[model samples]
Target chain A: MNNRNVILVIGAFVVHLLLQVLVFKDIVMFNVAFCFIYVGFLLLLPFEMNNMALVVIGFIAGITVDIFYDSLGIHASATVFMMFIRGQWVKLITPRGGYEVGAAPTIKAMGFQWFSGYVLPLLFLHQFVLFFVEASGFGLFFFTISKVLSSTIFTFIVLVLGQYLFYTKKASA
Target chain B: MRRLLLFLLRHRAFLLFLFLEIICGWLIVQNNSYQSATFFNSSNSIAANILSVSNDVTSYFSLRTENKDLAQEIARLQAKLDEKPKEVILVDSTTNIAEIDTLEESRYEFQTAEVINNSTRRFNNYLTIDKGSVDGVLPNMGVVGGGGVVGKIKYTSNHYSVVTSLLHADFYISSKVKDKINLCSTKWDHLDPSYASLLFVPKHINLQVGDTVVTSGFNSIYPEDVPIGVVSTVQIPEEATFFNAKIKLVNDFSRLSYVHIVQNLMRNEKDSLESLIQPENE
Candidate 1:
């Protein structure tokens, strides 16, 4: 809603997309970098972000991944599903004191323990939804489970890396 | 009504997200058209041309071996020529041999076109041969090379004819195992190139390893006794009434070099027979 928050989400979204297209595409080894880009959607949403904005962001995020992966829109479905579940997740994670004003989510904002708790659950959700959609299309349980597990591990690693690079305490949450 | 409108306004973003996702999913499904886009695959043509050029460049270095092989073939043919009976040459002039002219035309009565494009990886593997309508290639003709059976013509342009290779799951050649007298059709398993499967062979038939498999004269498309492959493994499940055998293909398409396409003078009659018989079953 504010200029800083809009710039933050939009900037992260664009860079997240370009990295998936340009950088992650070239890295062929473990496919870790691709899972991280999807984290941008989860990470950019504010503590008390609007449900509508979260859903919109989720669709954009999934479509961004969809364009590069060339997989017939599996990411979009999963990403929207993740957005729908994020509200309940926030309600659980948010303290009685509630979210601080004008502070974007980070280790400093929610503390390392709380942040990990937040990320791990949503990462699992996103990875599970995506892996299942793709695997369901193929009708293979082995492939689906392997994909979800591998993607979750990769997503966690990328999410941690994303936190390191982007999260900096401006005014101290 | 005002409350409903307010509820709709409140949930607009979720609705939009679903709409966008459905649109994107639909777009992706639409993009995956079954028929190959002629324009999209025109780039594949360029890639095929580049690949042919690249092969030509490397093949030029192998010219000595190629020439040696060609000369060896010529010498072998020449040796066979020596054994020909005297009256056979006289009778040839009185027959269809007189109608054919030109060095290229005389050799095989067909062009030895380079297989510029071929894919043996799909369920229905189609081959794109460099020979086309202009090169005297036509629909319903047969293509063969180092391997016994190559494919049949599917689509043709001025300079290319897409062939349905025997490796295609969609490929069903009316064939039989030579010497074994096992009458059945043959098709590839879509997994391996060095292997194919024989279908409709009755369980009562005797199959043996090293038994030569060839085209049955039942199909006019291919000359009888053309080698398809040998039965490597035969399986007859107790519940199954028909026998299925795995065949070891003689020609490995992965290493295809030169191919010989066969054109029958009476393809139309046989073609109609197949088409007429095809619908009767279904």
Candidate 2:
């Protein structure tokens, strides 16, 4: 990454972290749905970034939120697990034309339909792993699953809002 | 050797993922152990400082409700003062000087604190108070709100302390039915913050809806007769020896903003006296 891009990514991570800790940490909908906007940091990374680097970044991002949530390693485990599976996810969702090397898989880079298809599954996977790991027992099975479902929808809405507000579609020309 | 090197290089990402996952898993296990989890909780200085700043902004919204709670507390205290005794109990005045001096030396001292961070939705909820060891708050100190028992202090940093709230899983308070000899333990089921189950009440004891529950004073941490909750439901399982009473907690944890930490001044003395029966305990 160029110095400017690196600075922008770090700044984005900091903003996401601050939003997660200072704002979203207290926002619970019906005591189930939770907004985890920090996951956007990992999702918005450049497509061609190294897989190893992605996992490390995800771990760091997760731990930053974990520190504030008082959830020690739960978020780290889920985020890293999601990052580990991200490579396979990318291969599964590859377009027939394939991705351009420098492009990010954002709603702006790809069309809205493509972006929704790409992000939804990954978001659900992260939410599923996160809430289950947090619940930590089979006794909370139904409660945890409901939490995962609601949180996935809640996080996806926030992600969509963020993408539309900040991300711009550049001309292929 | 070249093939093996290439294979290792190719799978390095997966290997790193595995390594990080293991480390995080270890941390999760350590955190659940409860004894050494203090450093990873919100009571840690960095997290506490940040939350305190955020609380400063959000606490403004709750000012009206907090004022109401404070006013109610003052009224309760005023009523107690208004009910002064008509006559002195002691007829003899000779030894009353020494007795009065000892009575004035209360065993429990109260320290006021603001709850900068609190969560009720979590299964194991905790409240972070903006006072810590430096402010004479210590681990295991009993914390109470205007209505009733809040929790026990779990960890402390320089300027903050985490209370393992009454709504937490595995939290049990020794309690008794008001004006009754029945002693039982109360615990939250994690399903609801408003209710906790009173356990080990003998089946024959009659319990009414709205019967008061209070701290039993069996444990030195909390003083006797601190209101905990009111009986809301009574259940007796078939062939079971005990009645389970669900209590509606008086303190609404979702709106908790301020609390008082109870410091037992006579804790050392009480502990030393109790330890004589089990000399191995230090």
Candidate 3:
């Protein structure tokens, strides 16, 4: 990524973190579905970003949210785990002709089908680890599973809608 | 050695990931302990300021209900004041006797604070109040809303304090049924925000629905007889030794805007005296 792109990414990071803590923190539906829109920012990092940098960024983002949530390390651990797996997941599901260097994995850059395939599993894994870790064990097996599934769907829908609303479509390579 | 260095270099990202996770694990464990003051929480000055600003914007929407709740609380307190017996003073000029103090000294002092941020949907929830060390608010002080028990102060900074809400899964308060000698513990079931379960009530106690639960005063943290909740459900399995009961919490956590922190003046004395027995037992 260019210096300009790096600056823009940093700006987006701040925006996402603030919005998550301030606006989306209070937005819960049915007492189960939670909107973790910050995850969208992590998922949309430039495709050429190094794994090490991605993991570090994820830790920073998650820890920031954890502070506001008073949840300590649950979000950080979950986000770090997801970021570590993201590189391999992206390569495994690379579309025909592969991705353009420095391109972001957004719905606009990658079509809806490929984006869903790419983002859904990663989002699920993130939420799964987060809720389970917060719960501390399998004691609330069904309840935690329901929370994970509903939150994944809730976060996924908001993420897609947010991308469409705020993110401008980049021209095809 | 070169081959080992190359292997370590090749897996350096994974190693870093593991290291970060270990740090996170340590943080999680460290924060789980009660009354361990730490900085990364919402009670930190910057986070609390941001939350208070956001609350300033959104609290206007709830002004009507807030005013109504405050009015009701005032009316309740007024009724309690009127119920007290009137004091009579006798003049004895011939003896030149000094009058004894008629007013009873209260052990608990309360300070009002605004709730800047709160959450109920999370399994372990916390609240950030606008009061802190500057206001004499400290960790372990009991917090109560107009309706009933809110939480216990967990951490405090200069201008803000975080409360471990009653809705938190790990939080438990010593409590008992009103007008009964049997003591039980109230703890959140992590299912609903409005309800918490009462544990350790013996099966033969004959608990009924709608019984009021109040603080037991067994701990120095809270004053005795603070209303916690009203029993909503009561059940006992055939083989079980204790009754399984749930109480509908009096405080509506989602709409909580203001709380009073209960400071027990004699808490240090009580705690110190209790600590004296520990060494002999060991």
TM-score of the B chain in each candidate versus the native B chain: 0.68, 0.88, 0.92
Clashing pairs in 1: none
Clash pairs (backbone) in predicted model 2:
none
Q: Tens digit of lDDT per residue, candidate 3, span A1-173? A: 67888788899899999999999999998889998989999998988888999999999999999999999999999999999999889989988898887778888888788889998999999999999999999999999999999999999999888878877555231
Tens-digit lDDT string for candidate 2 (A80-129):
99998887788788898899878888887788898888778888899888
Cα lDDT of candidate 3 equals 0.89
Worst 10 residues of 2 chain A by lDDT: A164-173
Across residues B1-282, which tens digit of lDDT does each residue of candidate 2 receive?
Answer: 999999989999999999999999999888666557357778888888889899999999989988998999999988877764323435457866323344434878999999988888777778899998899888889999867999999888888888889988768999999876458999998777888899989977887788999999878889888999999988888999988679999989999998999988888888889878885754
User: B28-136, model 3: which lDDT tens digit per residue?
Assistant: 9989975677899999988899999999999999999999999999999998778653432345556766454533247788899999999999889999999989999
lDDT of 2 at B276: 87
TM-score-based ranking: 3, 2, 1
Please identify model 3 stretches exceeding 4 Å from their true place.
A170-173, B86-104
- Residue A62 lDDT, candidate 3, scale 0-100: 93
DockQ of each: 0.14, 0.74, 0.87
lDDT (Cα, tens digit) per residue for candidate 1, span B145-202: 6646787775566665666678754468888877566478888865567898888888
Of the candidates shown, which would achieve the greatest DockQ relative to the real structure?
A: 3
For model 2 the local lDDT of residue B2 reads: 100
What lDDT score goes with residue A7 in model 1?
88
**Model 2: DockQ against the native?**
0.74
